[model samples]
Target chain A: MRFDVTILGSSSATPIYNRNPTAQALNINERFYLIDCGEGTQQQMLRYDIKSSRIDYIFISHLHGDHYLGLVGLLSSLNLNGRKKPITLFGPAHLKDIIQMHFEYSETTIQFDLEFRATDPSKSEIILDNQDITVETILLDHRIACTGFLFRQKRRLRKIIKERVEELQVPVEYYAVLKRGVDYFATNGQVYPNNELTTAAEEPRAYAYCSDTLYNESYFEQIAGVNLLYHEATFAHDMLDRANETHHTTALQAGEIAKITGAKKLLIGHFSARYKTLTDLLDEARSVFPETELAIEGKTFVIES
Target chain B: MRFDVTILGSSSATPIYNRNPTAQALNINERFYLIDCGEGTQQQMLRYDIKSSRIDYIFISHLHGDHYLGLVGLLSSLNLNGRKKPITLFGPAHLKDIIQMHFEYSETTIQFDLEFRATDPSKSEIILDNQDITVETILLDHRIACTGFLFRQKRRLRKIIKERVEELQVPVEYYAVLKRGVDYFATNGQVYPNNELTTAAEEPRAYAYCSDTLYNESYFEQIAGVNLLYHEATFAHDMLDRANETHHTTALQAGEIAKITGAKKLLIGHFSARYKTLTDLLDEARSVFPETELAIEGKTFVIES
Candidate 1:
C-alpha cells in the first residue's frame, strides 16, 4: 500500500511571491484526499500534475480564507469537467452553506453527489471510516472553530507463502481463512499450522495533519506515535509573542509538539510571508525534533510501514 | 489621463495551462478598478505588478465562480495588509450576504469598510460616478444575472496653453476659470477669447467590458463608438452552438458586436480550454472586425483618446 502527502501551498495567512497559502494532497493507497484548499490550490495541483478527478474526499480545517478559499473554485472546476462521482467534504458546519450559496447564485447544478459532514471543533471524534482506513477529528486551539485530521490505515491480512500453499495443495477458497491465521485441516486428517503457512501482516501506518492552531497538548494523546505528522509553523520562536496572540504555533512550538507526540517524522509548513527564507524556522524545529523537514511546495513525503 | 486594461486571467470557465480564469485590472487616471476576479487573480496581480492597494472599486459581472471566486481571497489579503481605505464592490445582491457569511464564520472583523452596491442585471444604470469617470452597467444575456461595465471618462477641463497664458499675463487666481473654456476678463476690462487661451480637451475616452455573455445586441446602443471594447469569445464559429447553449459568445459574434458598436479596438478574451491555439479565433474575429485583438494574459491595452 502506498501512502504519501504532497505539499500544494505552504504560505500562511496570505499568499505572497512564489509561496501559496496552506493546501495539501494526501494519497492513501490510490485514493486522493485534499486537505485545506487555500487560494490557488487548483493551480498548484495543475502545476504539480496531480489529477483533481482522483480526489474523492476534501477536509477543511476551518473557515479562514487562507484555509478554504480555493474550495469553491475547485468544486466548480470539477463540475465543469463533468465529474459524476460522489465527493465527501468534511469541515465546519457553515462550509456547506457557503458552497451551496455560490452554486445557487451561479445557477450551477453540480453533476456529482456532494456529501457534507460537519465536524465538532470542540471534541475529538471519528469522522469517517471505510475498509481501507479510519479518520478522526482532533479539536485544535484556534481563534475560530478548527480541527485537525488523523488517518489510520486498517490492519491487513497476513501474506500467504505461495510455494508452501501449492506444495500442501490447499484449496483456493481457503486462502482467505488461511490468511486470517486459521490452521487448515485436510480431508486426510493432516493439520497444517498457520504460522508455517503465512507471515505476519505489516503494521498499519498513521498520518496526522494540524494547522492554524496554537501550541496545546490536549490532542497530543490522539496523535501520539503517528508515523508522519504535519504541523503548521507559521512563525519562528523569535515571534513567539505574535504567534501566541494570533493563536498560531511557532516553529519551536511545533517541534516540541512533535517531540511530545513521539512522531516518527515531522513536516513543518505554513510559513509566514514575512520570512523570505525559512532556514531559521527549519533549524528551530530540527533543534527540538531531529526528524523534521520543511514542507516545500510540490514535494511528496511517503510513509513507510 | 491614463486609461488602460491589464489582462490578469483570460480562460473562460476553467483555468488551464498558462491561462487562468477571467480577471482584469482597469486603470483610469491612476485609480484602479478590478473587474471579474477569478481564481489565482492575486497571484496574477503580483505577476503583473498591479498594486492591490490601489484598487478601490471592484465590479463583478455575475455570480459564476470564474468571475468572483477570487474576490474573497483578495479582500482578505487587503485586510491582512492593514488596508484602511474603504472598498466599494458592485455585484448581485447575494454577493454581499455571501461575503458577510464567510467573514462571520471566520470571526474576522474587517478593518475597513466593504460597501456593496447591488446591480440589477435587468436594467442599465449608472453604478458609479466621480470627478474622474462614470461607470454604467450594461445588462448582458447569460445563464444568470450578468452585467457588463461601460467606463466613460468625465468631460475634461480644457488644457490651458501655458505659454499663451504667461504671454497674456493672466492672473494666477483666474487660471482655474480659464481652463473651463471661459473667456478671461482682465481687471482693466480687456477680454481674451477662450479659444486663444486654451485648447479643447481631448475627447473623453470610453471603454466597455462584456464578459461571459451571449451574443445580444440590446446593449449596443449604450456602448456605441467606445474607444476600446472587451467581449468574451469563448468559442469559434464552429462551436457556435456550444457557445449559444452555454450563453457565451463565439468569436464571430464578438467580432460582429465590435463592428456594430463602432468600437475603435476590440479585445476578445475568455477563451475556451478547447482551443490550444487561439490563432483561428483571432482570425475569425478579424475577418468581421479589423481592429480586433486577443486579450493575452499579462498584456495591457491602452484606450487612446
Candidate 2:
C-alpha cells in the first residue's frame, strides 16, 4: 500500500506573498483526509488537483484564523458543487457555533450531512477507527487548547505461495485459510504447517501531525517511532526566546522532539513571515536531526514502512 | 487629477474559483477608497498592487458573506502590519456588532481605531465627503437590503497661464483667486478677467458601482452619465428568467442599465460559476451596448471625464 502526505500551506499566523496558511492532505490508499483548513484552502486544493469530494474527514487543531479560517468557504463550495456524502469534522466545541452563526446570518442551508465531533485537547484519545486506519489525538502545550493527531494503518494479510500449496494438494477453496496463517487439514486427519506456505504480514505504517504548539516533551512518548512526523517550526533557533514567549516552537526544538521520539523522518514547517528564505531553518533542523526535511508547499512525501 | 476605477472581484453569494467576490478600488490623486470587501479582497488588493495603507475608507454593500467575508481578515492583517491610521468603515448597523463579536471571541484588541458608520441600505444618502471625492449610496433592488455607490471626484482648480499672469502683474497671493475662476484686482484697480488668465477646471470624473441587484431602472437616474459604470452581471442572456427569480441581473440587463443611464462605458462582471468562459457574456452585453467591456481580474479601467 502507498500512503503519502501533501503540504497545502506552510505559513504561520500571518499570510505572506506566495505563502498560504496551514493545511495538509493525507492520502491513505485511495481515500483523502484533510487537516487544518486555513484561509483559501479550497482554492489551494483546486490548484493542486485534489478531488474535494474524496475527502471523508477533516481534523482541525484549533480555532485560530490561520488554522481554520478557510473551513466555511470550503464547506460552502462543497455544497454549491452538490456534494451529498456525509463529512465528519473534528474540532473544538466553539467551531460549530461559529460556523452555524455565519450560515444562519447568510440564510444558507447546506445540501450534505455535516457531523461535528468535539475533541478534548487535554488528553490522548481515539477519535476515529476503521478497518483500514485508526486516528488518535495527542495533547500539546499552547496558549490555547491544541491537539495533534496520529494516524496508523492496519497491517495487511500475508500472500500464500501457490506452488507450495499446490504441492501439498491443497484445494483452491482453502487458500483463504492459508492466507489467514492457518494450516490446512486433510479429510484423513493429515496436517500441513502454515509456516511452509506463507510469509509474514506487512508492518503497519504510522504518520503524525503536530501544529502550532510550544516545545513540550510530554507528547514524545505518544508519537514515538512514527514513520513520518510533521511538526510546526515557526521560528529559527535565534528566536528561541521569542518562540517560548509566543507559545511556538523553534526549528531546533522541532528537531529535538523528532530526535527524542525516534521518528523515522521529520518534516518541519509553519514558517513565520519574517523569513523570506527557509535555508536557515533547514540548516538548523538538519544540525540536530539529520533526517529532517523542509515542508515545501504542494509537495508530497510518501510514508514507507 | 488622475481618477480611475479597478474591479478586483465581482461574484455574488458564493465565490467561485476564478470569479472573486465583490470588491473595487477607486483611486483619486494619491488616495484610495475601497468599496465592498468580499472574500479574498485583500489578496486581490495585493495582486493588483493597491496599497492597503492608502485606503482611507471602506464601503460595504450589505451583510452578505460574498460582500463582507473579507473584512475581518483584512482588518486582522492591518492590525498584524501595525497600521496606525484610523480606518473608516461604512456599512449597515449590524456590521459593527459582527466585527466586535469576532474580535472579542479571538481575544484580539485592535491596535488601530476603526470608525464605523451605519448606512440605511434601503435609502439613498451621502455616505462620505472629503476634499478630493464625494460618495453617495443608491438604493438597489435585491433580495436583501443592499445599496450601490456613486463616487465623484471634486472639481479641481483651473490651470493658470504663467506668462499671462506675469503680464498682468498679478501677485502670487492673487493666483489662488485666478485658479478659482475669479477676476484678480491689481493695486491700481485694473480688472484682470478670469478667462484670459485661467481656463475652466476639468470636468469632474464619476464612477458608479452596482452589485447584486435585479434590473431596476430607478437607479439609472441617480448614476446617470457616469464616466465609468461597473454593474453585476451574474448570468448570461439565456438565464434571464432565472436571474429575475434569484434577484440577479443578466449581461443584457447590465448593458441596458448603462445605455439607459447614458454611461460613458460599462464594465460587466459578477459571473455565475456555471459558465467557464465569459466570451458569450461580453458578446451579449456588447450586442446591447457596444462600449461594454468585461471586468477582467487585475485589470484597471480608468474613469476619464
Candidate 3:
C-alpha cells in the first residue's frame, strides 16, 4: 500500500512569507485525493507535479476562502484541459451554490460531471467506502462548520511464505488455498500446518487529516491509533487564549492531541503568518510528542505499516 | 509624471509552462491599478513586491475565469491584512454578485468600503475621471460581454525655462500666469512672450489595454495614437480560423490593430498554452508592426511622455 501525503500549502488565514494557504495531496495506492484547496493550489499542483486530472476525489474542510478559493480555478482549468473523467467533490452544501454561481456568471457549462456530496459536520459517519479503504468524517469544533477525515485501509488476507511453500513442495494450484489459512496436503499423505508455512499480513495502514479546529477531545477516540496524523497548529502555545477565541488549536495542543490519540507520527502545519521561524512552534509540539515534524510545503510524508 | 505598465501574467486560457494567466499592474503617478487579476494574481503581487494596500483601483475586463478569478482572493487578502483604505472595482455587473456571494458564504463583513461600478459593454463611457487621468471603456467583440480600457492622461501645465525666465527679468508672481500660456508683463514696459519664456509641456501620455477580443475596427478611433498599446495575441497567425471561432485575436491581427490605430508602441501577450517560446509569435507580429514587444511577466514598460 503506497500511502503518502504531500503538503501543498502551510499558511493559515493569509498566505504570506512564501507560505501558501491550506492545501494537501494524499496519494493512496497511486490515487490522489486533494484536501482543502487554497488560492494557489493549481500552481502548487503544477509545481509538485500532481496532475489535476488524476485527482478523483476532493474534500473541502469548510467554507473559509483560504480553504476553497482555488477550487473554481482548478475546475475551470480541468475543463479547459479537457478532463473527461468525473470528479467527486465533498464539502458543505453552500459550496455547491458557490460553484454554480461561478459557472453561471462565466456563462460556461461544465464539460465533465462534477458530483457534489455534502459532508455532515455535526456528526461522525462513513462518507466514503471503497475496496481500498473506508473514509469517515470526524466532527470538529471550529468557528464555522468543519469536519476532519479518517482514512482507514482495509486489512488484507494472510500471506504465504514463499520459502516455506517451496520447501514443502507445495503445488502451484494450492497457493491460493495456503494464503487463505488452509492446511496443505502432501503426496506422502502428510499435512503441513498453515501457521508454520505462512505468516500474518502487516497491519492495515491508516491516516487521519484534521484540518482546522480548536482543541477538543470528543472525536479523539475515533482517530485513535492512527499510523499518521496531520493537525493544524495555527498559533504557538503562548497564544492559547487567542486560539481559543478564534476556535483554532495551538502547537502545544496539536502535540497533546497526537499524544492522546496515540498517533505514531505527527505532522503539524497551518502556522499563523505572525511567525517567520517555526523553531519555537516545532519545539513546543516536540516537547510533548517525540515523533513530531513540521509539515513543510511540497514535502512528502509516508505512512509505515 | 510617472506612468508604466507591469505585466504580471501573460498566458491565455490556461496557466502552464511557468506562465500565468492574464493580469497586469498599471502604475500611474505612484498609484497602482490592477488590471485583470487572474488565478494567482495575489501571489504574483507578493512575488513582485506590489503591495495590496496600495491598489485602490481594480479593473476587470470580463467575467471569464481566467480574467477575474483572482479578484475574490485578492480582496480577501486585502481585508485580512487590515486594509483601511477603500477600493473601487469596475467590471461586469455580475462580478459584484460573485464578490457578495463569497463574502456571504465566508461570513465576513468587509472592513473597507468596496464600491463596485458596473461597466456597460454596449458603448464607450468614461468610467473614472480623476485629476491624473480618465479611464474609458472600449467595447470589444467577444463571446461574452467584454470591454477593454483606454487610459488618457490629463494635460499638465507648461514648463518654464529657468534660464530664460531669469534672463528676461520675469517676476516670480508672473510664473503662474506664464505657465497658463499668457505673456509676462514687465514693470519696465517690456513684455516676454509665453512661447519664448516657457515651452509647451510634453504631450499627455495615453495607454490602451485590449483584453481578449477578436479583430474589429469599431473601437480603434477611441484608442488612436496611444503611447502604449497592450493587446491580446492568443494564437499565432496560422491559427486564424481557430482564433476567429473563439473570438480571440491572432498575433498578426494584433499587430495590424496597433498599426492602424497609430499606436506608438505595441505589447502583445496572452499567448496560447501551445506556445512555449514566443519567438515565432513575436516575429509574426513584428512583420506587420515594427514597434512590437512581448508582454514579458514581471517587466515594466514605461509610456513615453
Candidate 4:
C-alpha cells in the first residue's frame, strides 16, 4: 500500500509570488486526507491533479486564515460537484460555526454529510481509528487553538506460509486463525506452531504534521518515533526573534523538534514570504537534523518504516 | 485620468481549469475599486500585478460564495501588509457579522478600518458619492439579495485658457470662478464671456457591473448610456432554460440588456465551468450587440466618454 504526502501549498500567512498558503494532501493506502487547507487549496489540488473525491477526511491545524481559509470553498465546490460521500472534518470547536455561517448567509444547502470532530488544543486526543490507520491530535503551542495530527498505520496480520499450511493439510477455515498467530489444532489432534506456519508482517509506519505553532516541547513525546514529520519552518534561524514574536517556528527550531522527536525524516514548509529563496532555511534545518528536506509543492514524500 | 478595468477573475460559481471566479479591479483616476471578489482574487490580483493597497472601495454584489468568498482573506492580507488606510466596503447587512465572527474566532485584530455600508438589494440606492465618483446600487434579479454597481465619474471643472486669461488680464483669484463657468469681470468694467475664457470639460464616464443575476430591466434607466457594461453571461443562448432556472443570465440575454440600455460597449463574463471555450457564448453576445467583448482575465478595458 502507498503511504505518501503531496505538498499543495507551502507559503506562510499570505500567498505571494506564486507560492500558495499552507495545505497538504496525505495519501495513506489510497485514502486521502487534507491538512491545513489555506486559500487556493482547491486550485492547488487541481494543478497537482489530486482528486478531491478521494479525500475522506480533512484536518485543520488552526483557525488562522493561512491554515483553514480554503476549507469552506473546498466544501462548497465538493457539494457543487455532486459529492455524496460523508466527509469527516477535524478542527477547533469554532470551525463548525464558521462553516455553518458561510452556508447560512449564502443560502447553500450542502449535498453531503459533514461529520465534524472538534479537537482540544490542550491535550492529545484520538480523533479517528479505522482499519487502515489511527489518527491522533497532538496539542501545539500557538496564538490560538492549534493542534497537530499523527497518523499511524494499523498493524498488519502475519502472512501465512501457503506451502507449509498446505503440506500440513491445515483446513481452509483455520487459515485466518493461523494468520492471526494462533496455533492450528488439526481434526486429528495434531498441533502446529504459529511461527512455523506464518511469517512476520511489515512494521507499521507513522507520519505527523505540525504547523503554525511556536517552538514548544509539549507535544514532543506524543509524536516521538514518527517515520515522517512535517513541521512549519516559517522563518530562518536569523529571524528567530520574529518567529517567537509571531508564535511561529523557525527553521532551526523545526529541526530541533525533529531531532527531539526522533523522527526519521523532517519535511519543513510554511516558508515566510520574505525569503525569496529557501536554501538558507533548508541549510539551517539540515545543520541540526541531517535528514531534513524542504517541502516543495507538488512533490510527494513517502514514509517508510 | 485613467478609467480602466482589469479582469482579475472571470469564471463563475467555482474556480476551475485555471480560470478564476468573478473579480474585477476598476482603476478610476488611479484609485482602485474591487467588484465581486471571488475565491483566489488576491492571487489573481498578484498574477495581474494589480496592487491591493490601491483598492479603497470594495463592492460585493451578493452573499454568494463566488461573489464574496475572497473578501475576508483579502482584508486580512491587507491588514497583514501593515495597511492603515481605511477601506470602504459595500455589501449585505450580514457581511459585517460574518467578518466580525471570523475575527473573533481567529482572535485577529485588523490594522485598518473597515467601514461597511449595508446595501438594500430591494431598491436602488446611492451607496457612495465622493469627489471623484458616484456609486449607485442597482437592484438585480437573483435567488438571493443581490445588487449591481453603477459607477459614474464626477463631472470635471472646465479648463481655463491661461494665455487667453493673461491677454484678457483676468485676476488670479478669478481663475477658480472662471473654471466654474462664471463670466470674468475686469477692472475696466468689461465682462468676458465664460465660453471664451475656458473650454468645456470632458463628459463624465460611467461603468456598470452586474453578476449572478437574471434577465431584468428594472435598472435599465439607471445604467443607461454607460460607457462600459459588464454583465454575467453564465450560459449560452442554448442554455437559456438553465440560466433562467439558476437566476443567471445567458450571453444573448446579457447582450440584449446592453443593447436596450444603450451602453457604448458590453463585456460579458462569469462563464460557467461547462464552457471549456467561450467562443460560442461570445459569438452569441456579439450577434445581439455588435459592440460586445469577452471579459478575458488579465485584460484591461479602457472606458472613454
TM-score sort, best first = 1, 4, 3, 2
Cα RMSD to native, each candidate?
1.7, 2.3, 2.0, 1.8
Interface RMSD of each: 0.8, 2.0, 1.1, 0.9
The second chain of candidate 1 has a TM-score of 0.97
- Model 4's alpha-carbon lDDT is 0.91
Candidate 3 clash pair list = none
In terms of docking quality, how is candidate 3 classified? medium
Please provide, for model 3 over A172-274, each residue's C-alpha lDDT reduced to its tens digit, 9 standing for 90 to 100.
Answer: 9998888788988899999989888889877898889897899999989998999999999999999999999989999999999999999998999999989
Per-candidate chain B TM: 0.97, 0.96, 0.96, 0.98
Q: What do the candidate models score in CA lDDT, each in turn?
A: 0.93, 0.86, 0.91, 0.91
DockQ of 3: 0.67
Which parts of model 4 are misplaced by more than 4 Å?
Answer: A161-169, A183-197, B185-193
Per-residue lDDT of A19 in model 3: 88
A6-71: candidate 2 lDDT, tens digit per residue: 888899877677778889999998788999988767767876888888999999998777888778
Compared with the true structure, what per-residue lDDT tens digits does model 4 show for residues A242-283? 999999999999999999989999999999889889999999
Q: State the weakest 10-residue window (summed lDDT) of model 1 chain A.
A: A121-130
Query: Which digits, one per residue and each the tens of the lDDT, describe model 2 over residues B157-271?
Result: 9989999988877889988878888987779988778898998888998989898799988888999999999999999989999999988999998888899999999999888
lDDT per residue, candidate 4, B23-109, as tens digits? Answer: 999999999999988888998998889999999999999988888888888998999999999999999999999899889998999
CA lDDT for candidate 3: 0.91
Score candidate 4 by TM-score against the native: 0.96
CAPRI band of model 1? Answer: high
Instruction: Compose the digit string of candidate 3's lDDT tens values, residues B1-305.
Output: 88999898999887885788899999999998899999888888888787778997999999988899888888988898899899999999999989998899888888999999999987899999998999999999988999999998898899999999998778798889888899887888887778999899878999999988999999899999999999999999999999999999999999999999999999999999899899999999999998999999889999985
